[model samples]
Target: MDKAIIVFSRKGLFQKTLSAFDIRSREHARKLWPLVSFDESRQMVTWVSPSFENGRLRRRAHFRVLPTQTSYNPKQHFDNQENHRWNTVKESTEHRLAKELITAEISRRLNYGLGMPWRFKDKDVSNFPFLGNLLLGADRVVRLCCTKI
Candidate 1:
């Protein structure tokens, strides 16, 4: 099975309409990422996964974006599509750590509560360090930061 790792989320002013996934080999120094964008004429979303050679990464015309059959609805957005995509992807023990890392980070941002019914597999997934109260406090800080900007 091919392994992929999400190095980090690349969000900024320049790439406003795209989300990138940086994948790298944990055993080697190789790096790769998928840059997702919308193709208006094709009416389909594009996923461009790049391969690197000569240990250098660059924007070149040799790469191609493959079109998947999946069509995203603008009204509903990615909430439903993400759930379906997650279920369709083949799960393996190799990527368990990467999955847990992303899950924990999202759970942290959402402030997962013990009372919530959401579960990972058959068990309820709860956030450690109990940040519910902290999130409330952080909301004030976030507002202050936003207002300053």
Candidate 2:
């Protein structure tokens, strides 16, 4: 699944730093919504506390966006496109397990996978694939627009 940054304002549960709930339209930005907050000391972003209950945090993994052939692919050690990208593991393991970060509207809207760029090397890291692989208690749901499902 793709990675997404869910801003959690420290002021309160509903309060947030960023007004709009958005990031790049890429796979990472769409699938995985790791609720997080900005880290001033490290000058980077960090994950926040998730309300998920379980002992399976390690089982959760990052969705590999882009294709294996593309430089933006997280699986590869590419040195480009670091402008808006941030390593979730590098920052902190705060909000890795979210209770219900993704909203119903976004999930339904993303089912089509329309904006996903075709993959030239490997399969695109869209929500369908990501959700299909969602852990038993990962708490996520996604539909595929390309398929009849």
Best by lDDT: 1
Give per-residue CA lDDT, model 1, range 1-149, as digits (tens): 12222222355312434233422232222232322233432233323345568877664222233356353344465567766776766466656666667556646675643222332342356443332343343321121111111
Number of the top-ranking candidate, with TM-score as the measure: 1
Tens-place lDDT per residue, model 2, 85-126, is 534223333432232244444454356442323323326654
True-structure RMSD for candidate 2: 23.6
Least well predicted 10-residue stretch by lDDT in candidate 1:
140-149
How displaced is residue 49 in candidate 1, in Å? Answer: 4.7
* TM-score for each predicted model, relative to the true structure: 0.21, 0.14
